[model samples]
Target: MVQRRYSGRMDERFEIFLACAPGLETTLVGEAKAAGFGPLRPDAGGVAFDGGWPDVWRANLVLRGAARVLARIGGFPAVHLAQLDKRARKFPWGEVLRPDQGVRVEAISRKSRIYHGGAARERVERAISETLGAPVSDDGVRLLVRIEENLVSFSVDTSGEPLHRRGHKEEVGKAPMRETLAAMFLRECGYTGEEPVIDPMCGSGTFVLEAAEIAMGLLPGRTRRFDFERLASFDAAAWEAMKRGAARRETGLLFRGYDRDAGAVRMAGANAQRAGVDGTAVFACQPVSALERPEGEPGLVIVNPPWGARIGKPGPLHALHRSLGDVLKERFRGWRVGLVTPEAGLARATGLPFLPPGPPVAHGSLKIRLYRTNPL
Candidate 1:
């Protein structure tokens, strides 16, 4: 198959933001820098870097824990609705949206004259349809217009559904972590596919499966469609090439997950199979105490133990953390450990020396923090 080449040159980069879980911006930025995409600047919800459309697509395909990819199309001064309408009409809508396809407009206004978001959306929608011949839809082309002070900035949601919905997880547990967030947390935990990855209290195999996928070189978006596919300038041929050029293979990286519940083990296996990594993940119905060190050496051991908010009573959770800490300290040496917990006290229960915590990630309504110990 002929692979498609993105129109822009390799050096042509756009301002790309790596959206991460709250408090995870610096960590995600560090991951991007470690992966050599740097000169990263920390932003409100993510890290901002400059890259081309290819980088954008690659970020979508490879980034494990981003919420959404947004493109800063342009910004301008707009003190009134007329200026907003005229600017919206003149802005290159044709370059972003197809005339035949529909789009949905959403907006937020701060201390600006155009205070009505609905009015802004309607004006932008009208400009796209009347001036650019694009059809209008309710849910497509999520146009986010921000009016702060007298400046109006427009951004488009390049990632259609959040990257968390990798499209393979059909079944979700009561309090399932988003695949994107899980991946980011794993990265924050220092997972580099060079070490052993273990999710002891695997709820549904999210961490293990994501690790397997990364080790295998499978593009997370390989089986998924992006909103860019519906854009006017979307290059179907280039996308096909990128897709066909993807490398999928097995590796020696040992990924293991153990859940005390049998049903969770089954679900993890099923999710792995769905994600095309069933053969790679080692799933067990045993408890965390049974988790063994990878054959060769100690690497990165990461876990998302149960959070009390999702599982109800806190008694079992504390016991679970204590046991997990004991097991790690007793069995695994020379391995870096990472724990995700809703309560700092729960993490403290593990009796592990932890670094200062990062910002909390939104796991449902409860905020979860990632705690890491030194590289043992």
Candidate 2:
């Protein structure tokens, strides 16, 4: 069901959904509350709040855990395909959509008379193009419509692309962990961007760079364009002011990533430079056997090592985990560890004392879990 708010003006306010991976709703809510955004309501796949256009802009600018922001525009009852076309054509399209900007409608149907999803999409697309004069093109804005049990609801994706892109990090390893998931794992490990961070198996430096950005106070959407800018409610001056008001600070803390692959180390370094955190986020070509504690306060050691679901056979991966576990237990005295993988036996092979595993999180096709430990 589309969540609703009763107090605000019905015409001005709408339900805003911050979509994320299913199991990470709690972590996303944590980030939202820390960023001062909401009286959040966490559901299965995301968190929701009641807001208008400015709130949407702020969410797109500040949030790090959300994949995309969806604004619930409006809806009506459509028992059949022709009724969907009729109500969609009369849906006040001009109030939010412009005549020049192109739009492409996508829809899903479940337990409804309008069982054909493609046919439903065609009806909505024709309505927007014919009624509002917005051209229907593949490269245009995406308009999502959900029809269930004869009720139709519409939403538009405010973020043009997934938030994990972060407008940087051009190169990535084969089984790269997403930046959004990385942020959540960091938060779950009680990381507040205050201490040093080390990733012994950093692929393209996603974890280290995210920590650096959090510590430096850089906004996630600072360097990217959003689909909301093309909407009719966009206020250019207000958006620019919001961006200008955010300030980035210098951090004396060091975030390090050590990879055995020299090419991966070079790629991570280049990505850090592009992200403008090269001064604080440094990369070195090394292995877990050579891992050492940094010359400062103990921080979190988060890693996304090779596992059976994504790559590598279980036998060698188990040895790698054992080696990593041995190193952390010996050299690192006060640091906590967060390991991301799908194999439970592999996490146990680490031999470090990990708390009870959390619920499984969806990463591509594999269901991965985050295994953590107290300061060792």
Candidate 3:
């Protein structure tokens, strides 16, 4: 197969935003910087960069920390509905949006005279529908119109689905970790896919799978299709060539995942198979007490143990946390640890020498933090 370099530039440049969990913007910055995306500006919930369509495609293809990618197309200041409608009609809609493909327009107003978001959305939707002859559908290219202080801006969701949905993991356990979050967590622990990784309570094997994929040089978006493909600016042949240009490499290390439930182990194995990283990852049905260090290398042991809010009685949970700490302290010498929990008390029960916790990240309704330790 011929590996061609893709240089598919859009007609216009864009301000690309890579969205992530609020606390993870810096960690995302690290990953993006390592991937050669530079001059990064980190915002509250994401990072922004200047690039063309090729950068958007590459960001969707490789940036594991981004929840979704948004392209700032264009916008204007409109004080009222009539002005908004008139301005929206004059803006060029045919540049990036396809008339044949459908579109979905959504609007939000904050401290703007156009207090009614529904009315604003209808106005823009009507303009696109009438101007480009594009049909309005519930499931279509998402056009987000932000009306802030009477200035309305348009952004297109280039990633149709969240990047966390890597198109694998057909089966997930209760409180399963998302691939994007798991990737960020792994990076925060300084894994870099260069060393072995162990997830003791590896529900559905998110960390191990992500580790294996990274080590094997697999692209996250390889198995999935992005929403950017639907836009008029998309180039299918170029995208196909870009996907083909990636080559997988061999790795000597093995990513290990253990779960107490036999069903979870089976599910994880199947998920790894689907992700094409099964060859480099190993999964087993085992308790934390049964976890022993693997030979040949001292790597990182990261776990998202079940928290008190998630399940079971507190006493047993505390003991479980204590036992996890004891096992790591007594056995896994020289291996760093990254533990995620909802409470500091549970982390303290582990008795490991932990550094300060990172900012609390929202995982569902409960907030969680990652507590790290130097090699013990």
Candidate 4:
């Protein structure tokens, strides 16, 4: 695994944006910085950093919180459809796109003279086909076109699938928390992989497995493929070396998860095994009331419980929250808690002293928030 040094030249560098759930921008920024990403700039929905192609690969391969990584290829002012088509044709698609591979162009316009999204998309698609001789398909590499105030920018979705699909965790429970979101929430709770984590309502053991992997220094995208692999600029040898050179450490602490459903426990255990964290992650089937603190120092107890958005009714959920709060207070003293839900009232039902929560994050159609409590 030879370390190929990249001369950070201006021509070789480009702007890369790591998209995340809206409210978790700060947490994602911290994770990105820790992963040696950049001098970062945090925005509404993501964090921006400057790097070359290798940085793009590292981001997709190692970032635990980003939903997708987008590379800003080029931008110019296009007031009308003809100008957009001309500029798009002149853009260097061959540098990033292969002739045999297909592409899907998506366009969005806001406060711009060329305001028709469909027309913009059509022009971009035609330009790509005419200029690069590439076929267009729905499942091809995604190219995004943003025409805002007559300025058009082109970006390619480097991450084909969402980062949450880590090429493992085949089984999922109802309304399961995405692995990306789980990782960000863990970071928001001040988790640094030095303490044990418990997800009492662990649906498919996302939090527990992610914690174990972090503690062991496993790469999130180790088993996954990216859209960059299809690009013309992809370097197979360098990428193989990067993957082979990922550092893996050992931890004595065990991350634990509990679910009332026997099937969920089995699924979680299987997912952990596939993630190569089975030795450090433990999953069991048991009700929350039966949860007892493991023998060790106090750690974090995080749960993404049913929020009544798609699951149970609000009344029973209130009781469930109350019971969870009671159990934690009575038995799990000195342990911190991080609870995620959509309703403030439901979070209040827990009766745990929570600090001011961050902004609401868009998850599907619903907005969720994280409520953190000091050590009890």
For all candidates, the clash counts are: 9, 0, 0, 1
Query: TM-scores of all models?
Result: 0.91, 0.96, 0.96, 0.95
TM-score of 1: 0.91
RMSD per model, one decimal: 4.7, 2.4, 4.8, 4.2
Candidate 3: tens digits of C-alpha lDDT, residues 196-275: 99999998999899999999999999989988898878889988888898999999999999989999999999999999
**Against the correct fold, how does model 3 do in TM-score?**
0.96
Candidate 4 regions off by >4 Å?
A: 1-11
Alpha-carbon runs more than 4 Å astray in model 2: 1-11
Question: Candidate 2 clashing pairs?
Answer: none
Q: Per-residue lDDT for 59 in model 1?
A: 74
Clashing pairs in 3: none
Candidate 3 achieves a global lDDT of 0.89
Candidate 1: misplaced stretches above 4 Å? 1-14, 34-38
Candidate 2 on 99-129: residue-level lDDT in tens?
8998878889999999999999999999999
Per-residue lDDT of 113 in model 1: 83
- How far residue 104's Cα lies from its native spot in candidate 3, in Å, is 1.5
lDDT of 1 by residue, 80-159 (tens): 89988888777767666677777888889988888998898788888888997877787677878888897877777889
- By lDDT: ranked, best first: 4, 2, 3, 1
